[model samples]
Target chain A: MDAMYQALLAPFIDFAFMQRALAGSLLLSLASCPVGVFLMVRRMSLTGDAMAHGILPGAAAGFLLFGLQIVPMTIGGLIAGMVVALGSGAVARFTVQKEDASMAAFYLISLAVGVLIVSLRGSSVDLMHVLFGTVLALNDAALTLIGLISVVTLVALAIFWRALVAECMDPLFLRSVSKLGTPVHFIFLALVVLNLVGGFQALGTLLSVGLMMLPAAAARFWTVRVEPMCLLATAIGMSSCVSGLLLSYHFSLPSGPAIILSAGVVYLASILIGSRGVLSTRNRPSRHRTA
Target chain B: MAEACITFSDLTLGYNNHPAVHHLTGTVAKGSLTAIVGANGSGKSTLMKGIVGVLKPISGKVAVKSGNRIAYLPQQSELDRSFPARVVDLVSLGLWPRRGLLGRYRPEDCDAVSRALVAVGLAGFEKRPIDTLSGGQLQRALFARVLVQDADLILLDEPFNAIDMKTLSDLIALIKRWHQESRTILVVAHDFDLVREHFPQALLLARQPVAWGDARKTLAPENLLRARQFHEAWDETAPWCGPDDAHSHHHDGEHHHHHDHAPDAIHKGAA
Candidate 1:
């Protein structure tokens, strides 16, 4: 354990790239967790996956055109994310198919498109690096992009929070009464796309969705209210980012997937030992209200 | 000093691009207890959606007096109770404009939610997850949602589709009290006897205002026949309501005697 701590903890504190990955991962997790819970509530988890896959070709294109530039790549990915959201949204509205099936079709085609593009450009290794990024490679630019994107997404969500929640819980009535129903819906999709793009550098496309979904899901074990769930998710996400970064540094493990796996562990633990989690004791005697 | 509070002047409503309810011209008097009754697919839900602004009218005006806060209770079937929302939180959504975005619950808002729950006979259910409730309990939870709206106008769609009879009566009594409080309430119902007993005014819609006025009287023999005819006309075989024109065209309907059909003639063609 001493040797393990030295290797993992020792380097994480001093290295600039490690610090960037840690900060970036925490922000991405904090951003995704609360939003992920709502998406799950709305039964749109698959839609999130679709957004990730859909953003891939854009990342590859941005790389081919702009090389390692964060801003251009982030923009390309954001646009692609919006297209996925809008495309899937159109399918959700116009077609008779359920959201999951439509999402599956969308992401499959898009992922294939990304893969084909990567192959065509003879940069499959570069594509893998883009998707499965290590903390060792993260720069100040990626961290800055994450910070700015987080602020924008957070502010936009904060502005429309109520309207968005109402739509997510039960849409039939809200859709009727709300004046900006369609706009609100698309704007939320846009926010999700933006968040994914923001986290693009630290988590890569694959781990971004996980960090968003799993931590929030883990927090669900502790609370029933939306606000509490959100707070809890942010806490869980931050813990994972910090711990996973230190662990990754000591062990020379990949930071992105390491952080995701840590979050996944927390999620499972919540599902098992959490206060209101599925496996937790129910029908407890009411003597201890505080407990 | 007095005018019909909610007026649908040549209004039509639909889904997608097809029309479900044709041009419907009617006025609901202020503080009136109105039941909208029709057989299944008689454009009853379509009419309810139109009234609530869930679905838009294709071409006509759905005018309501300005500055009215409307509390709406939708069909329970449409809500996802499995969500981790507590009954109190659900009720608290009624405090929307009052709570403002980022506004914490004031003492008054909390009191309102508590009172609403008590009114629905769900006083201690504040912390309960919505999924734990029975059908009757779910309906009561919805009643609590409307109560917190504190709205002068309340629109309920299929408020009692499937619940125990006792719970149904409990719901009706709560609604009656709201009506007595001078709030204009529009209930979407399938129970003929319930409407006859509770609502003095009704708009019996079979895609085209099948029968309007005097709930007890309009639901009578001749009116029921007209309702049946209009009901058949607005059946499922027809297309859905139109886009941006849900207010004016109903495809399944035909000419009717009680309602003025001048604007409806154009709607019938589109239908």
Candidate 2:
């Protein structure tokens, strides 16, 4: 038991940076997972992925302007993500192009621009840090930013819960009743961008949405309702973060990829043995009902 | 006759400015039950959307009585049925206008939702997710939602398509009850027989008003044929003529026959 504790828990207990990493990740998960669940429910999982990649240019711009500061990077990322979200929507509405195609186009451009900007001023090591994240090196400022974003996300979700759900399910019905339809949708997107920006520093641009969408997708196999699914997703995300952090500490692996891989493993396991999972045959006795 | 609840003056509703409902001029009377009947592309749904403020008229005015709340039930195809929501929660959304966003559901609100569910023969289905419901059951749930809305003006777009007979009858009874309460109801329906049996007034439409009065006469064989002809003759590639240009075209001999006879046909139905 002592050996197991030393192997699993000592790193977090003894090292401040490890503790900070865990705290940052746990906060990121709590804030982002519910947003991810909403994304899944709204069938906007790919949109979230596009937005994640879309933030890279903004973060890179922030880095160019303000050097590795948390506030500037977060603000930059938030602006970029919102622009992509709204731009894609506008393109879909006004032009013949569909939203997904427009989003893909915008994110690709953003990714290229972001890489170019980073490569111009920063070293390869610095570029790697930005792309893959520095979870093991979380400063107090990064932890504070994560914590603050988590609070904002939770509050926003609470306030917009009913409106958001109604918007997703039947926006026409919502619009017929009140004028909050468009505002609610934009606010929800803002929250999504906010959470993505929050998760960026801890998980990096490429892998941040993985922390969100994977746990959310995995949570679908375990539950049917929204609330329970959100809670379950939070659990899955936090566990993945903890286990991934431990693996990184022990095996000298890259923290961000390790965390995402841990989430992937959980997803795979859920698909196999979860209550409504693909491999769970309890719900399906035969191809056709016996009746 | 009661005062007009909804007044449309030369209304032309459309998508991308290509009028789906062209130069429609009419008034929907308060406390009256009206049925909008036409061919598949006859602009029944588009007119309903215009009434509910979903679509803006291309070049006309749709005036509603001030302080009169409107409840709209779109086609079931418009709803995301797979959304994760209990039947109770979905019905409770009807109270949104009164409660607004972020308002807590009071005890009476809960009671209203339960009463609505029970009224629709869904007493024990409060906890069931909407995705689990069948077509008929989902329609019932929607009707339950409209009931909780308690709006003075109600619009339903093809409320009975693919619905079972029993559920249809129940829904018809509910509409009758709303009528008894003096609510203005407009239903878009394809069942001409059902409309003649239950609705006193009807608007037969095919891109434009074919006839608009007594259900029995408005659905006349000649009018139905005219509506079909008008629908079939619609030019998909025609450039959107503005309201003024549309009026000019009405004077031209080719367009004059369809435009000139509409009100006369309506008057014939009234007489």
Candidate 3:
């Protein structure tokens, strides 16, 4: 128990890595909260997942092509993520097919494409780092990059938030009321792509979206106001990151999974405790069924 | 001389290049209460959309008198009432156009929101999460948002849908008060009786407009036949049904919309 306390509490006193991860996570949570709020309202949480995993190919391409340069690889990954988002949005708008189906189709194709290219080239250790991430290798430069990306994302979100909400609530009405609907939608999609790319070094392709989604989902059970909900989501994300980091350190487990599992715990807990908690469903008012 | 609040000159409303409403002309007076009515696929919603600028007409001009802010309420089917927003939060969105980024609302804005809530008969629901409200209350909450906008040009699509009759009566009373306050209102209604009793004027539209003017004259039997025919949508050349899939469609048969730019064309027609 004492040793456990030391690992959880002592790390703050000495290790800069732990401090950086905590700070990074806090900042990241702040950044992602607004994004998550909109994603839930827009019913695009899964889309975030697609974008998160969708960047793998570009990351792989950059590393293999440039021999592991951070800038080239990140740039490739960003572009790839955006392409997947924009393409999916366009396809859904134009076709009769559902957006979720389109997203899944693209996600699998992107992963397969990345894998195929990596295997065919026989030179992909750098690519794996991008795909699975290198949380332990989150040196000062990586932290700095993550911090900058998070700051940029939050600032943009703060400015465009009202328009974003209006658009999400009613695109047809919002388009009529404001002339910026198209711009707002594209800007939001771009932000999602950027955040997924920013978390690439720490969260990896498979896990980054979980952090984005689960904390926000957990926070939804607590409030209806956008501002409060967003703030709570950020706090949840930060706490998940800290606890996951501590648990990861103590157990020598993968930091990403620890964080995701922590977030999942919160989500399940909220679901159980929300008005229709598992045992309370019979007594609860039935949810209004939407067409 | 001042221009009419809205003016449509040889306007065509459509989604793609095709037009659902072709060669349409009209105008709306300031402080007028206008009703738009038609059958399913009659392009009633499309016309409202066109007026508000949600959809762009292919080859028509819809011009609005400048500097007139607008408050719009879309069809109920389009909104997700399950969101966590409260009645206050939903209404406050109306104030967004007034405040710039980083601009906080002054006390007066808050007062306006309160007044709007009261107007919609949602006086005590300032902090009520949207989900707690019944269908009628939800409509009222949305209407409160429009009041917060306090805009001179108010456009509502299917405002009375999914509500009990008492709530519909309450909404009509609220709309009447707004009209008395000198705001021009364009309401899309599915029920024929609501428009005849409350509005002095109406535009009966199908794939194209069958008639426009005093509600009694516009809803006359001969025009009603045209409205039904236009609504049944036998013709492809109408400007309201634009060739593109995303642009024009019918919802509850009372409005026409062009996908790219509905506002400009609608004002022209409204005028």
* A209 Cα displacement, candidate 3 (Å): 1.5
Better of 1 and 2 by TM-score: 2
Interface RMSD of 2: 1.4
After superposing candidate 2 on the true structure, give the runs of residues whose Cα lies further than 4 Å from its correct spot: A93-96, A279-291, B233-271
lDDT, candidate 3, at B230: 48
Checking candidate 2 for backbone clashes, the offending pairs are none
Write model 1 residue lDDT over A1-291, tens digit each, in one string: 978767666566667777677778777776777778778777787677778888987887787788867777778787777777887777876678866777777777778877776776746678777687655566778788788778877888788888777777666646645565567788888888887887668778887888788888888789877888888888888888887887777677888888888899999899888998766677566687662
Higher-scoring candidate on DockQ, 1 or 3: 1
The DockQ-based CAPRI class assigned to model 3 is acceptable
Better of 1 and 2 by DockQ: 2
lDDT of each: 0.75, 0.84, 0.75
Ranking by TM-score: 2, 1, 3
- DockQ, all models: 0.52, 0.64, 0.45
Which portions of model 3 miss their true places by more than 4 Å? A1-5, A93-98, A122-128, A274-291, B1-3, B15-18, B229-231, B234-271
